[model samples]
Target: MSPFCRKVRLSLAEKRIECELVEVRYWERDPDFLRRNPAGKVPVLKMDGKLMAESSAICEWIEETCPEPALMPATPDARVEVRRLVQWFDDKFHSEVTSNLLYERVNKKLMKSGYPESRNIKAGAQKIKFHLDYMSWLLDHRRWLAGNTMTLADFAAAAHLSALDYISDVDWNRSENVRDWYAKIKSRPAFRSILADVVPGFPPPAHYADLDF
Candidate 1:
């Protein structure tokens, strides 16, 4: 599962926007898909007859177009924090953890790429401890990742964590704060579709969709 795609889904759901979901095999580089996005990335959004690529930009466009149930803060400073945390998860956490674990363990098999590398998995397992600890620290100070209110930052972090949770890679017990935070977000109505998602070859754990979990 692509966390980037999940993040966009969360944004749309939170805004109460109705959208048709399309599954694309970006790696296959289908001509029509490439025409929409030459970069060949998943999570591309086609809205108002225009093809939109890049998850973050597409999300910002949605936020701009639909202002209700705002995912971004009103103040510039608060918005920056949201953007910063969004970047943190999408870039740093992604390179260090997701690409190492989910890509290796799941994407490899799905793409028929290769076997999972133990070293990368181990590195991802270890790095996640630090990220969880950091999340715990952040939760210690604020109600949400970027501030007291839930924003795009929460969805960004949840996107990656939810995908990893699907594969049972996240150790929720590592931090009660982080665990509690996730349980809160995971219970939202917007998360319903995410919880119900199922992959062809992999079945999620029982707790994956459990709201109390």
Candidate 2:
């Protein structure tokens, strides 16, 4: 599963917007899928008679249109922080961790690209500890990642972490703060569908959907 897609899904769910879920094998370069997103990347959202690509842009459009139960903060500084963290996860974290671990282990097999690379997996496994510890330190200061209130930053981080958790890549015992923060976000109604997601040939661990976990 693509964390970018999941981030958009979580944003829509949080906004209480109803949308149909569609699976697109972008790697195949199907004409129909390509028409929707020329970039050949995931997280394309079609709404209001328009095709929108990119998770950050889609989420921002959603927030601009809905404007209820705000995901971004009111102040400009706080909003900048949220955007910064969102980029941190979607860009830096994705490259260092998700691409190495999830894409290497699961996506390659799903796409029939190639066998999993042990070196990338090992690098991902090592890098995640640093990220988790950084998250713990952030939690030690603020109630949520980026600030006191739950924002898109939290969803962005959760999107990546939840996908990794689906494959049991996350070590919940690494930090109590991070674990408790994840548990809180994982138990939300917005996370129900994500928790129920089932990837063929890759069954999630029992703790995957356990709210108590």
lDDT tens digits by residue: candidate 1, 79-172? 9999999999999999999999999999999888899999999999999999999999999999999999999999999999999999999999
The lowest-lDDT stretch of 10 consecutive residues in candidate 2 is 15-24
Model-by-model lDDT, in order? 0.94, 0.94
| Residue 197 miss distance in model 1 (angstroms) | 0.9
Candidate 2's displacement at residue 162, Å, is: 0.5
TM-score of each: 0.98, 0.99
